[model samples]
Target: MERTERFCRIEMLIRSRGCVSFADLMTELGVSRATLKRDLDHLRTRMDAAIVYDRDRNGYRFAVTGRQARRPGPPEASGVWFSEREIHALLTMHQLLDGLGVGSSMGRHLQPVLERLQGMLGTSDSEARELVRRLRVVPPARKPVRGRSFERLAGAVLERRRLRLTIEADDGSGERDRIISPLRMIHDGGIWLLDAWCHESEALCRIPVPQVRAVQTLELRAREVPMRVIEAELDAMPALRAA
Candidate 1:
């Protein structure tokens, strides 16, 4: 993994696990003790990550109460924020987006906002343009079900609401009406899946959006579905199971 990826992973680990010992970090990262110590020092000095020694825990911990002081602020607001490595990572993401063919649309719509970000880093427009050209990103394939239907189903799933769906055959033969409680939306192998709970079956199901002919929101509330059960069903799917 790249240094930036490692740093991001370390930050996430700290946030999720609270205090982390040197030995623990070494074990998790498979890095030498000296390397882990250097990374810790780099985070403290460059990223403003507050790592304090906890004698009782026998590890390094981020003091939650004083976190604000240690966290780097927005660049323009606080010129002292973000080290060179952080800036490089940010630029890399922009470059990746550019390479993905979405950059033209993003430049037309989101470039203005990104201009402010560039200003914070003291990077000129020409420099940003150059960076975009030099870096490349390959985006994954587009999924089925574009436009309004996709948006509606996504919203319903996010809000944890029930949806009245009509699944129609491609041959225009039959339709099935279902009241489904949306659980999760998964994008896999260039396909979008709405993992939901079918009230009629009292079981979890995966609905491909393209097969859904019509979708409408229902006043009926969503019911809690066990994540493990839903995951098991998903794993049992022929395509996923084959993989």
Candidate 2:
């Protein structure tokens, strides 16, 4: 089993059985003596898990509870513990969200999740913050989009609702309104494109999200299109071609 799985299993076994023998842990984890020992040490030192060997029972159990409840020990870690590899994965997620423009628009909504993961890491908050600060992601030049428009359009697509869009004419002729059924929102080459079925043209069209001057969600239900057809339309779009 994977290291993370083993860690979880070890905790579960200890919690369920009150105490678990070294041999039992090895058997349950399908690991060698040395590996089990390393895992226990990592749980104690790195994860701040208050696990202690019970000499009387000849087994291991949580120091915070069980028969030794009265005995004083180090405080148990408050939240879930993440392995080193998991910490790296969380850092990658943080960077990706910033790159995708979600941080500025949706940061407040997602801050709690981020904080929970950050707190669960096996490092101090300052260290985690320092690591995130050191690894900078410089995204390519991206077109600016109004957060409200993006949010409303995204909701309309998920809700299967139609939209009334005021799109800026390509030739500087001004804006025109089009009623469209949004199919999907595609982000490619630092631009957001709305894939929708145009009611006026009776065809699938890709609209640059930044070029949308105004947006309004309609009460009417959106028309559905097959996934294969959407893929074909996306393949033919000029924005998706090789630059």
The candidate that achieves the highest TM-score relative to the unseen native structure: 2
C-alpha positional error of residue 152 in candidate 1 after TM-score superposition, expressed in Å: 3.1
Give model 2 RMSD, 1 decimal: 7.7
Report the alpha-carbon TM-score of model 2 versus the true structure: 0.62
Q: After superposing candidate 2 on the true structure, give the runs of residues whose Cα lies further than 4 Å from its correct spot.
A: 1-84, 122-124, 239-243
Go through the candidates in order and give the C-alpha RMSD of each one to the true structure: 12.0, 7.7
Candidate 2 per-residue C-alpha lDDT over 147-242 given as tens digits, one digit per residue, 9 for 90 to 100: 667777888999999999998877668888999999998777887878899998888888888888898888999999998999976767665321
How much lDDT does candidate 1 score?
A: 0.67
* Residue 128 in model 1: lDDT: 68
Each prediction's TM-score versus the true structure? 0.47, 0.62
Pairs clashing within candidate 2 = none
lDDT tens digits by residue: candidate 1, 171-218: 668897989898887766656677888888877778776678788899
- Residue pairs whose backbone atoms clash in candidate 1: none
Q: Runs in model 1 with CA error above 4 Å?
A: 1-142, 170-176, 239-243
